[model samples]
Target: MNERVLTPRNRGFLFLDSHPAGCRQLVADMWEACPAPAVPPAGDRPVALVIGSSAGYGLAATLAGLKRAGVRGIGVSFEKGPTARRTATAGWYRTAATADIARAAGRDLVLLNGDAFSDAMKDQVADLVERRFGGRLDHLVYSVAAPRRTDPDTGAVHASVLKPIGRTNRTKTLVFDEEGAPEVREVETAPAEGDDVEQTVAVMGGTDWERWIDHLAGRGLLADGFSTAALSYIGSSLTAAIYRQGTIGAAKAHLEATARVLDERLGRTVGGRAVTSVNGAAVTQSSTAIPGIALYTGLLRGVLGDGLVPPVHQLAALWDQLTGAAPLDLDADGRIRLDGFELADDVQAAVAERWENARTATVADLADLDWFRDEVRRLHGFSVPGIDYTAPVATDVPWPGHTL
Candidate 1:
């Protein structure tokens, strides 16, 4: 059973069981709030394959592709279904919502659920593109987040760690109870040592990403002029200790390197281009589990204030790049930076200034804690504005593949 903690305001970890009504409302709100860039009359309608497309950035991107670009898509994920033991994962309900909405609008969608890192899953995707999508995909989006991966080459399990590479780092944040009383606390990251870096790389690195591409290319699944992108993150020096300089950061660095390799390889092999999109740091179920990201994002939300960009917005910017609504605006490293505003000199300066003086007492006044808390709960399909928390929400939500 999954661990769950709920708050009086209906904000907290979503335990076992599906909340279908809440998920449906969440999708509706996301769609309404995040309309895509204008799609020209004759512009390219992407036939896309999205790994991890059931939730977070991937889900948003998939929705935009369907609603704005009117594209058919295959969404692959490894989300759990609800059972007697517990509630269904948010991805399952989100997928159901997406497919239901897409089918109503006559948009074709197929949901593939499994270990995306597996070799068989890669083959499944290639065959899927060949059979259902005419052997070619205009776009392949990788937005997967997982802690562990089993090496198909050797059947070895590798788990990624979220610790500093050289030293332990102390991170402070607040926790709320049902009474809304806030308690200040510190979560520390132990130093990553021995095989931690290598294990983290094996679990989170770009080898699987490359393998996915290699398989697709071998099967002639990548369309001519197809574009592929995997998301990455690079915040400020403040997060460098825990993220940009830690185990995950090492993995990200390797991921970015893999993008360059794929850029050249895809161009040469399939007449396609591959690039990494550096996204802004924000709330997600995964990010909340990390040691320092919550505090960092809380401060970030406070500094950025009114215009804190969610992952969906970054995904929208990515969609814009694909549709010619915006240029790639490649950085010196040839990767896209959707965090341009977040990394701006003024924003960073303001945040750094406040961070120095931010204490437990000052965090609420300094950081946008309410937004951070809401976002954290929202990740678990809680604290949604319109959903009735006390109402009966069915646990069973079937895959939306019937819409295909």
Candidate 2:
């Protein structure tokens, strides 16, 4: 085994290396932090498939289903494994650790590492459902976040961008100065040009979700009352111009529309359901790359304090909804709103005030920059508490489940 005390190699918001031991600790921490279900699940050994299930809300949802809902989960993600010289992706380590945890708890949690948008990947997952999980899919959670996708039919590559739709946006964003201190600065983002919206929707929208459902249904893999949820976000007006009104929002709108279509079709055919669950913003790899989200989430964490709903809690409630233990609190648009606490009137008011007056001098006071920084580091398997960063750890860790 190759051993080294790995440190993070980063450029701005992007991280290039991950610590395997730290990722394991993060997964363990999440398992402990996640709350148990309010009541027992309705189904026995319910089978679930979580796409993008290595990190962020996907990972949380996977753990929630296993620990809180007693699910047999199959997680699919595309992540790079470690080589002799380089460490594996954070998702890779997280998935490996999660598989081990599930084994220790006597739960069934198989993982697949590959391109989820590809037709071959879907076929492989369907086969697993049929052979390994009794040919019944109880839940399908889509939490995929990718910069680009290659269409299986057309073989055309589509790349998604984070930009406003019609107008250029100027927003106060969080940046790190030369001294590595947090600073709030004004950043200008140009509007989406040409087929930017189309490309973004192709990559981030529900077309792939529809394809997954159609494929599974065709294979007769959907169980009775099978439900699917595609994760989305509709933030407050503080980030409306760059988030809810931006190119990514266009994709989310399309996703929600597709959910309606799938919900109707599933209900009509097999008593199933579908929804776009608008989750609360938290520190995730994808969210940090957005223009205003870093600043918005920082302020949100500061204002909400203990009230902020983390992804694991939101997904655990989703498990309740899936298993008849709780009702799905759907909005007028037939979408699940998990971000209610973040969008509370008082919370928004406080955050708005902070947004207006926040500067480098008061950023720490106005926002939870420390938490934000720690969470970002934690995402890449750094800055996790109780982790021995000085000790050499094996970088070549193998996933403890099936890989594609």
Candidate 3:
């Protein structure tokens, strides 16, 4: 692919030949183009830091923290390279938009591109907190979704898998990429090993969550009455075997477990609390890649469209909780169940019935599902409004504060 072809479809230009500088200019231009929105500054206007903050729930969380809570200065840690065949990562384009949004809102935003799991990155965050905002962060949102992680204690790298246990559960999925509409294709299965489960837990679990909190506390970057939360999800039983019961489920369980650890640790401080928001299923780059989920999402989309709650609304609710405007209710496992709408017994039962019957769902039946598909594609800087796709985009765009 041509390097210039990598620029986002919506705004600005990306020159591959000078990727670093181009990315930076793109970010700067986005900042310059932001629209100023009037928002009331509340309670000292805390500094918010978002990890995995480039796209999807992470980006939504960042926006909520700023627009809702009147957070002024922001820091984001995202993983995307300057030049790659895949073009700029969704997070890269999102940061540009986010910076633009913040600037338009008359807020200051700083973005850092790096591994959020690193000590160096943590230190960089701490220094920023100390220097810019007086070592006080009112809200911290952890929204990283990774397929692998290096065990800090063992120094071993673990990769997560997506497979079911016990038997081969074949399922049909709709091929939206085809112009001819939904085509059914049977998906093969793979049995997950014990190591797969364990490694998935290691990679997706709460160890890193704890580390971020610990490092922040140790560095004295945590402000009084600080609130922190992470995102989690649980789909229907149709996906339980592959999702909730498989490697990813193991990791989610670990993530829920980490919330308690963090709460306990942060509670020792003044008015500090850790929370886990169990989010509803939405189309995201990570979620779409999960097997058997696309069909379910499509069907559920149409079913829930009349009364379904969007992820942005859910995130806004989370922000409400963070700012003490709403009560923090915990489930039996001490985690927030924001997916209550989807997890409703009737909802899952309906989807499960469709799954069991193996009915061929058409695009009209899955129109709601397209929202997420479009959003995910937009995250990759494709299919967005206002950009001419025919024009070549430069790949070598300089990202502000992006360190290789």
Candidate 4:
């Protein structure tokens, strides 16, 4: 038996456990939030499809479907299984763990690992739902985060790049090294050029989301009066140039636009509802990969502290609201604003003040750097309980009710 304690090897932290115990407090709170509603929704044992349902918001939403609404869920994602050389991606562990929880609660969870942007995956999902889930899925959750995508229609490949859309934006970024010290690194991002917005929109935009919904509708897979939502984000003005007002922002703008079109189409076609929920930003697998996000999240924590909500908490809350008696309110553009607290006037003012004071010498001091770092590790099943780090982890554990 090889003894090992996984440690941060670069910006990509690699420590993990096979059987991870997520935050005890979070698990407790989620149990409380998971409702046994007497008055179920309009459907029978609600059926749901969560695209990209492996990590971050997607994982949270999948949990909500099973634990909160008692919905039978089919989760689709592009995740890898563990190999002899390395542990599987956090998304893989998360999917298997979530399935275990769901099955224990007497709910059903089917996981499909594949390229969601591919037409072949879409066809497989439609066929599976038709054969197994009664050909009617009432909820569609779109929460994909990938660096590149293939256009299912045209076969054109688009890669998403993280670069400022205008004049260079310089700032201090948070980076961790092998020594486990969170250090501030200087970074200068140049303006995007040569069809950056087009390329980014092609990859991260709502095209694939629409294609999924449309193909499902054509196949009669979308149940009448069904609801669909895609997770989105809008944070402090400090990051607007690099985030909200940049290439990614352009892609999100297109997403919001597509939601409007889908909203009307669904409403007219099947009395269905479509929305884009602008969720609060948190440290996740993708957030670490994006330029300038770690600094912003760290600074955000300095101001928001516990006020900021993680995705698991956020998803549970949203599900409670959606299933409760009240109707959902939409902004002028017909988008749900889940990023309310994150965009609050007080929070924004505090983040701005902190951003102004942040520097290489004082960034760690100005922000909740420790929480930011730990949360990133937690996303990958590190800092979890009930694990013997000295023993070799079983990377190829099979999911409950699944043959792998």
Q: Which structure among the candidates has the greatest TM-score?
A: 2
Q: Estimate the TM-score of every prediction.
A: 0.92, 0.97, 0.84, 0.90
lDDT of each residue in 24-117, candidate 4, tens digit only: 2234344555554456545568888999887778878887777667678689988766666565666776777776677778876788888999
| Regions of model 2 farther than 4 Å from truth | none
Which candidate ranks first by lDDT, i.e. highest? 2
Could you report the Cα RMSD, in angstroms, for every candidate shown?
3.1, 1.4, 5.3, 3.0
Q: lDDT of model 2 at residue 324?
A: 66
* Per-residue accuracy of model 2 over 1-404 as CA lDDT, tens digit each: 89998887787778888999899999998898888766665646899999999989999999988888889869999999998778999999999999988998888778999999999999999998888888999999999999999999999999999999898999999987645699889999999999999999999999999999999999999999999999999988989988889989999999999999999999999899999988888899998998878988999999987788878888888878876678878899999888888888898999999999999899999898888888898999999999999999998898775643
Better of 3 and 4 by TM-score: 4
Decide which is better by TM-score, 2 or 3: 2
Candidate 2 has a TM-score of 0.97
When summed lDDT is taken over every stretch of 10 residues in candidate 2, the lowest stretch is: 35-44
True-structure lDDT of candidate 2 = 0.90
lDDT of 3 by residue, 1-404 (tens): 34454433322112222222233333333333332234455556778887877656776677766676667655556656554555555456567656767778777677888778778888888887788778787788889888777766677888978877666666666555324344546787777866887887777888888898888888877888888998988878777877888778888888988898888878887568998989988767687778777777876776677466665567777877787777887888888788888888888777766665554444445445456455445545554555565666655445655321
Off by over 4 Å in 1: 1-18, 40-44, 177-180, 402-404
- Which scores better on lDDT, 2 or 4? 2
